[model samples]
Target: MMFAEGHGLHPGHENLGGHIRFFNLDSGIFVRVRLPLLTDHCVLDSVEGLLVLQRDEDTAIHLLHPFTGDIVELPPLTSLAMQLKTDYTEATKLKLMRHISASISVADDGVVRVMVILIRMMRAAVATSQDTEWSMLSWRVPSHYQPLSTGGKQYLVHDTFFEDIDPDVAQVFQMEAHLQDTPKLIVTIPREILAYPVYLVECDSEVLVVGHNDMSFTHLAVHRLSDLVSERYVPVKGIGDKVIFVGGRALCVSSKILPPTTGNAVIYQHPRELTFSQYCLGSSTWSLATDECSMSMSGLTQGPCSLIPHVFTCCSRRHWNKGLMYWRDNEPLTWKVKQKFRDGVNHSHDPSLISPTRLFS
Candidate 1:
């Protein structure tokens, strides 16, 4: 969890520079660092590793690590505050300032990457400063990158984002990926791009189980982690929506109108339609008459909403008013999940829980 430090400047300081502090519940440690203060309560601006508080002409942007006491000043054009369209009024800018913190995940390798959203302000629109954003903007810590020990208190990773950046662009980190050359097949089924994946199971270190985007079927693919490369995409399966790895078996979610279950169980919302029949893997086919629904073995990060990166399982519960939202796996949940709602949450076993060689065993 992150907490904003108060009392740095003055009591009535509205746009006072702020700092981000993080609390590790597992270790019971609280660390704080100086950051750019918010300029406006409504208009918040964020980029890859920085946050800006903007209200009218008074704007303060700070490039700081919430987990460490590192700070830098970013060029105006590169901050989200300056990326807004020329026609945008102060009110609209305030309304668009959104949270930019991304969930972090650790892979079998020690590398950590943070996913972010990037706005190609110049590429999207010439006249207006407002622009469309891409989801792939991410920051990462290489596997070999080591953190500096701060005396006997905390270990701090090097702040690479603060080093150098172009002044004309705004980048946001929304997700992270490990850069180990672990060979693995990643298949994005057609049409399932927007749906909550049903599952992500494991068969072996070499085999993975996943659902299709359409939420209509499932499939399996095998890969050798040692064969992985950079900026590469490999297909794993098609027409599936769920994946799970239990013992030696991998399960894929399928709503196909087949033996046990009949009729297309997928519901659709325009532009993104569901799939049809799918080939499910891992578990033996069962008759729906047995009165069995899907049982997830993973935990969901519940919030005002939930974001599922790939098909896995339901979060502890539903969001305030939405259904199962987007998926986010391999990331730690906030204290709200652990403390405020303990009984309502479910913990999933990590795929790495077993030996990678177990697949061959």
Candidate 2:
């Protein structure tokens, strides 16, 4: 499922009611989910199949399940400000909430853990189901590091270097344990490559660092890191038979899970335009998946969109648009485009001229 906030028509089309859209990957279907509470909210992150939406009304954060329409309300941002003993105005509180980065992890036993990085205070906090309270810890995270959570662990990645935060401290928010080993370095990028705007993605059990070079063209280098404690980051020619989707969140899917045509490719949206393209790793080329007519007509470029890999579980099946489509096994996933609500109108771009993949050297 690909989730996009705002309008489905053009980029920055926030005025089209500011609804949440869900594109079903299995059947190429689009479902628009409306959030009344999120009228003035901003999405901080998506994790464990839930979206973290921060309400502007009172600076409260909400956990919204797009499909089920279930919302879990967390404590407000003012609570954290008070706990930190910091006096802040409402405007400052709102600004701080917007800049903070967060991640969520859920265990098999249904234990949910949330970690947040307070960029303003340069501190971190952890909240868990057991405690039901925010544990603020004093760990000065570098301004460069971005918080990422995978498999119940939180990490901070900057360029080629990544540091794994101790899960113990993250679970209980123990400042002492975190202070003992502040920013434990796990991996570093090789000196030969100039990696800027690097993104860390966890696929299965492996961690992949994708570095995009924008100096000449938009070239990308993929490096696989060893264990969490290992210092080596080895370059990889390919990612077997899987397709990766990169954006605010990076996701990888096995070829068996998606259409064979999408195999061995990297699918991503244009950072500056309302368009999406595929980078074929095998052929080292870029191709447009959606035609210009469809893109322009649908106004698909207006908001924050995601390429989600969805799986169908039940043996029962349904088909739309064409012949029989099976849901079981590694059936090809569909792509969806959506929009959010904002105040301004967005201009459309010609996707033909915006070759995100071709920019790579």
Give the clash count for each candidate.
47, 24
Per-residue lDDT tens digits of candidate 2, residues 1-361? 3243213232113453545555543354667766554445545555566767666456567778877888776766666665665576544544454455566666688766667777556777766655545677665665453455555555555442233442111110112212323556565544344244556666666876665534333556666655313544345677777766665446666655344346766766544434456677667777753445334333333221222212211011111111112121223212111121132222212111223332111
- How does each model score on lDDT? 0.25, 0.48
Error of 1 at 82 (Å): 6.4
Task: Determine which window of 10 residues in candidate 2 has minimal summed lDDT.
Answer: 313-322
- Choose the strongest candidate by TM-score: 2
Error of 1 at 71 (Å): 1.1
- Over 116-138, each residue of candidate 1 has an lDDT whose tens digit, in order, gives 22222211111111223212222
TM-score against native, each model: 0.28, 0.59
- What TM-score does structure 2 among the candidates reach? 0.59
Off by over 4 Å in 2: 8-21, 24-42, 55-57, 66-73, 83-88, 105-111, 119-122, 129-135, 160-181, 212-218, 227-234, 253-261, 267-278, 286-361
